[model samples]
Target: LLGIARFKALSSLRKKKEDWIDDDDAAQVPDSADTPEVVTMKEDKAAALRRFVDALPEEHRTVIDLAYYHGQSVTEIGEVLGIPVATVKTRMFYARKKLGEALKAAGYDRGWP
Candidate 1:
């Protein structure tokens, strides 16, 4: 029932898109339409990042989230968490290395969006 309603919602959304975009931008979409440069990376990059976060150790996740997702400085995160700056730095390092390793293992190092 939820899925059906969601599908209907999406069906309505597709119709609504016609109103949101002008004919010029509508034609620009690839097959459907092309995305704007503001989007930067494609959906693959977002999926890869999600996978990286899921595979990371829990303890390091906070540091990674703070530094990568929130744009917080390592020192700022340390201050917020009441941990030493070095510990925060170490966590950030390990988190990045682990995410890199995970992404590499998934065969996404070079071809990721």
Candidate 2:
């Protein structure tokens, strides 16, 4: 029963996330009222990054989504995907490197924290 309930909750959250993706107006904005210039620049960068991530190979994209979107740890992603933890780590590493290179090619100069 508990497992079923958890699944239902996760399903609902997934649906909401999908809806947010489909609706650009649903994106969260800063409360401090960012200037139009800053907002446009940020949006452009975000769109570029998203395109890069979407272009990743399936395995790398899966790891990236599970880690960042679903907020799963390396071990958790491995368990969910039925892969070894080392594989998860490797996918993440490669995904990040690919994304970094793509972003650089897109002229994104901001350093990662």
Candidate 3:
């Protein structure tokens, strides 16, 4: 029940494009600098990341979404999910490892720009 509510809230938040990038970070990018190629590349990277994250197991994905997308700390996530703090940390560690491997496999070896 709680999980369902949390998932719904996160899903709604995720649907907002403005939530994807921080205001300060967005301000750093000049409108004039977004050449078509750069825009396409950025889109591709975002698509790839979304695909990879979506592929994660539900438990792992939940931890990642709460931590990154919602900017929640490990202790906060543990409380929200009713899991132990160590379990949350473990899930985050494995989630990050899997994401890194997926990105590398997808040819983002040098990491995101």
The number of the candidate with the highest lDDT is 3
- Predictions in order: lDDT: 0.80, 0.86, 0.89
State the local distance difference test value for candidate 3.
Answer: 0.89
Q: Which ten residues in a row have the lowest lDDT in candidate 1?
A: 32-41
Show where candidate 1 strays beyond 4 Å.
1-41, 110-112
Task: Estimate the overall C-alpha local distance difference test score of candidate 2.
Answer: 0.86
Q: Locate the minimum summed-lDDT window of 10 residues in model 2.
A: 17-26
Task: Rank candidates by lDDT, best first.
Answer: 3, 2, 1
Q: Model 2 Cα displacement at 84 (Å)?
A: 1.3
Give per-residue CA lDDT, model 1, range 1-113, as digits (tens).
99999999999988874447889998887773446642456566677878779778887988888888899997899998999999998988888888778878776664535
User: Which wins on lDDT, candidate 1 or candidate 3?
Assistant: 3
TM value for model 2: 0.66
Residue lDDT tens for model 2, 2-72:
99999999999888843234345545553677788888888888888778889999999999999998899
- Cand. 1 TM to true fold: 0.59
Residue 82 in model 2: shift from native, Å?
A: 0.8
lDDT of 3 at 1: 100
In what order do the candidates fall by TM-score, top score first? 2, 3, 1
Number of colliding residue pairs in model 2? 0
Residue 10's lDDT within candidate 1 is 94
